[model samples]
Target: MTVLRGRGVSLSAATEGGERAVSIDVEAYYRRYGPQVLRRCRFLLRDEEKAVDAMHDVFVQLLRYQGALKDAAPSSLLHRIATTVCLNRLRGAKRRPEDREDELVLQIASADDTESRTAARGLLDRLFGRVPASSQDIAVLHLVDGMTLEETAREVGLSVSGVRKRLRALTAVLQELELEAA
Candidate 1:
């Protein structure tokens, strides 16, 4: 008997004329790679809920290209697919209302510090309102969310170097604002 694999690879009877073929356990593959895929997606997406969506999208794409995944390097392949999914979602998304709500929540949450927190909140609100929307998102992702430059790049579809340049520009603006206030 002969069998055709999903990737179009074939296997025939193991005889003098046939070579033995190795089989992959798909369940094991999923178990082994699932956490890593989620982590990568989370790093790229920033938001926990959106990251879960991205992870699901990555798995769906992987299932669609099962044969290719079998042949390709899983980590790199998954990373590329996950990054693409995250970028697409980000590009399609508008400025979320939850972001503003979250910022307010953070401000309220920080009120435990009273006076200094009030000053910081005022400063941040003024500064953030002055920046472009995309720049503000990048800044919040990096500074408040504690994402690395590479992670911010993946989320915002910028190169790490480009993110660095933008961060520097933002920092300079913040310094000037601070000096003026002083």
Candidate 2:
């Protein structure tokens, strides 16, 4: 919710992990990003308490991955992480076998535009059905959250070309699905 407001300059420490694990100023980051992350959670989980919990969980994940963290785009990275955390929670809530045909991926909550949100809500399941699950993540980040290709690549830990290929594959599958739908 909060972190992806824009590109963030890196603020890390060179000290080894201890009581201070991440180099970044943690309190400042929470103050800067916590609102947006909470906003994101509320939008997705549709529960105030759950949203708060998930937002905190996002920061915890950031702490967990601080060692390998390279990109300065904390907002984008945190947004992706927040989405992932909430989706996992949603998925876990319904622990039955994945009813892929009927289940909507809750990450599409980022499709904030009214028309696009409605449009995306229905197509997303079909889109995921026809392509790799990772592509589904790419589509949500790029197409739904409106992150640029490079930003999406960094967030998803893929090369831009690799992201492009998966997106292209998604387009092909979408075309086939559209033709079938028609």
Candidate 3:
């Protein structure tokens, strides 16, 4: 979404001669792009409270880096921020799963699936070990989160073909690993 031009608070910048003002239309940006950012948070978080919190966190990051972030692609920037915020929350949850593990266990635990779990763990290590985490993020955005290749490229700051090549290489690795497993 485009950051609409309008009245906003100005920040002081230290220049060669003196301090100057850098004005950012933050309200206009929030008005135009808040819904998209909130939707992305909700999709990734699946919790109303956390999603709202994450949305606010994304905007806070925007405000924090207002001077550096350009207006060329605000939508993609917000989307990327939302994804990162939610992903960080998810990782944090892993650090302390006991708070919610009671119900989660009932839903996802399988007593007889040790072999499957081991196999899946091996597959994950092999797939993720050789690649950068950005590649894994791309895979999640495109394959898990259902983002388009163009969207994924924008979020990851890569070309569409670069994202595709990463995915292709990942797929090839998976295929080879599958054959080895077989």
Cα lDDT, model 1, residue 122 = 81
Candidate 3 TM-score, C-alpha based: 0.45
Q: What is the TM-score of each candidate against the true structure?
A: 0.39, 0.42, 0.45
Instruction: Give the clashing residue pairs of candidate 1, or none.
Output: none
Give model 2's TM-score versus the native structure. 0.42
The digit string of per-residue lDDT tens for model 2 on 33-75 reads: 8898899989999999889999999988877777667546778
Each model's lDDT? 0.68, 0.73, 0.73
Worst 10-residue lDDT window, candidate 3: 99-108
Clashes of each: 0, 8, 0
Per-residue lDDT of model 1, residues 1-182, tens digit only: 45545532232334555654434434555666768878887887788887887888887786676644454466777778888988887775442222333454366447766797888788777766777677788877976786877899999999988887776666666667768899
The C-alpha RMSD in Å for every predicted model, in order, reads: 11.4, 15.4, 13.6
Q: Which 10 residues in a row give candidate 2 its minimum summed lDDT?
A: 96-105
In candidate 1 the C-alpha lDDT for residue 110 amounts to 72
Error of 2 at 113 (Å): 47
